[model samples]
Target: MQNTAFTTAWRKGVIARYLTVAGATVDLTGCGDHTYYRCTGCGHGTHGVSVIERVARERAQGHAETCRALPRPTH
Candidate 1:
């Protein structure tokens, strides 16, 4: 797996976010004021207030269990 970073940027009048993890690029979708992380690898995602916070929370909550892009064992 590769070291990844989650970032967000403003595109137009909305927030655009993406996550680069283990060589896969996951595009985030925004709904209302919440952002969702959709894994390009496994097609799994969860909603958060921010992309960075979402990814961090997902990882901390053991997203690797279902995330194909991040297959490393979580402890």
Candidate 2:
């Protein structure tokens, strides 16, 4: 038997998310007027995007489409 921790964007204040090719998650989170994406697989993410929602979404989708890193263990 094993246990793993599962979380959600809404619960964590994330605005959106995408699933990577390896089943990992790319979370889109925002603070105040700034938005960004962070990958749970290989720690790939965005920075200094100002308040551009489209750019954040675009980068998140692009990374999700190509990222092959498997989801890291939740232990």
Top-TM-score structure, candidate number: 2
Backbone clashes, candidate 2? 0
Clashing pairs in 1: none
lDDT by residue (tens digit), candidate 1, 1-75? 334343323334333334443534455555443555555456556544444545544542354343446423324
Predicted model with the maximum lDDT: 2
Per-residue lDDT for 1-75 in model 2, tens only?
221114532437678888887888888888545887888889988754555778888888999899999878764
The lDDT per prediction is 0.45, 0.75
Q: Ten consecutive residues with minimal summed lDDT in candidate 1?
A: 6-15
Model 2 Cα shift for residue 68 (angstroms)? 0.2
Residue runs of model 1 more than 4 Å from their true location after superposition: 1-21, 47-75
Assess candidate 1 and give its TM-score to the true structure: 0.34
Superposed by TM-score, candidate 2 places the C-alpha of residue 25 at a distance from the truth, in angstroms, of 0.8
